[model samples]
Target: MLAVAAGCGGGGTGADHSTMNRRDGSASPGAAGHNDADVMFAQMMIPHHRQAIAMTDLVLSRASSERVRSIATQIAGAQNPEIRTMSGWLRSWGEKVPAAGAKAGGMDMADGMMSDADLAKLKAARGERFDALFARMMIAHHDGAIAMARDEQSDGRDPDAKRLAGQIVRSQTAEVRTLRGIAGGR
Candidate 1:
């Protein structure tokens, strides 16, 4: 018992993304009795989702491939709702939501976020260049989200946040395969 308690003392374990119930059997209202990990997950993922939507918007205007454009539309359709959901979580948690125009916030590289200059370059490229770059960048972007999601799954305290983390990992993993297919054709 002493050894178990010692091991679980720190948040570094990244386990326990399971059904968490307090002795009182009531989780914190909207925050699901969240810890710092939950808060960080919501805050970070909000901007990451925003950037993905922006990239999809670019794909709509520039990409000539019907499949690519269609996938972009699908991505925006999926992520916009998710963005709203995360925002709600943040508000419910009494945490400040990142601005819509906020940059990647932090962990930009780890989060697979594109820089302003990278976005500008993507915007300027035309035809195949656009399609290929779009797929490549988005794959990288999705990969970052997956990584963050996995972290949340291991470390987050909120049940909703951890569940969403698992979902993100699954969906984005599939999307990465699709993106790879799209990039392969080029």
Candidate 2:
């Protein structure tokens, strides 16, 4: 199901230790090779990504056009693996990873996470309404991710985590452009 957008180019599970991520899941807490910025990036982005995945799942069936569904698939393909990768980093760092697949909540709207009411509205939308709302919300969501990735690039100490942050910026920034087009420049 997540492989639906295999060719769309959302980064991977940080499998390439040579470049994107150097830390392995087996590394002990003392050997995590990460700083607080890396930990915060993993902790925050994991749930952020989960929320995006949840939205994609909802949109796939209800989207009026094939294009929207395709984007949803792309997002899931990219993010689901990244979530696993981040969770692995957290575990290696001896941090408490949020429960797997936790729905987005509690984060302030300024952080770009949708509130319960927003999710409920999205859940209740249909046809073109869903498409428009999704484009708007996802663009906002992607912007949030880009911001966090930028923070990691600035404050994170691990080369692997910084590489992953760069990947996130590139991918999600592109997604924001596409989503803007989908939103008719709104």
Candidate 3:
């Protein structure tokens, strides 16, 4: 019976202690419940959504077509609240809420974000030219957001975070199709 007791005790020798405690040796209540993917999704998406809001603001000022203006308004309405929601999640998780003006160069380029030059060009464009550029750029931007949301759905652990990710995927996927139609001059 002693031999059996010792064998069972040995099973914990190589156990992962990180799961029980944080790196700083503090007992983490929430750390064990959430994963890296959940943290990353909020971090990256906050800035992505901020940029989308910025793009929409620019288009709303110069777009000649009412349809373009309406779309831009809708984009801003949806994303501004989402930005706040994700920021709240990061705060609750004890993670850094990325600064509003922070550059997102470290994020995946294939995630469909625009470059500085692209924004500058959009800023310079007006009327019909502005509408076309806005449509094209926003289409790509929404595609990137959809990709990140999909990753969160697959890899995230927190229920609230996963639910928000699923929502982003569905809404942004529809927006992509609409933006594409506008870009194609429909």
Residues 1-186 of candidate 1 have per-residue lDDT tens digits of: 000000001133443332333323333533336666766777777778888888888876788899798888878877776776666666765678889788645556556888888899999988788988899999988888888887777776766667777778777888889899888883
- Indicate whether candidate 1 or candidate 3 has the larger TM-score: 1
Q: Between candidates 1 and 3, which one is better according to lDDT?
A: 1
lDDT value for model 3: 0.69
Error of 2 at 141 (Å): 0.6
**lDDT minimum window of 10 residues, candidate 3:** 1-10
Residue 116, model 1: lDDT of 85
Writing each residue's lDDT as its tens digit, candidate 2 over 17-37 gives 221233445653333256666
lDDT of 3 at 157: 63
Count clashing residue pairs in model 1: 0
Ranking by lDDT: 1, 2, 3
Please count the clashing residue pairs in each candidate, in the order shown: 0, 0, 0
Q: TM per model?
A: 0.83, 0.82, 0.81
Local distance difference test scores for all models:
0.71, 0.70, 0.69
Best TM-score among the predictions, by candidate number:
1
Checking candidate 3 for backbone clashes, the offending pairs are: none
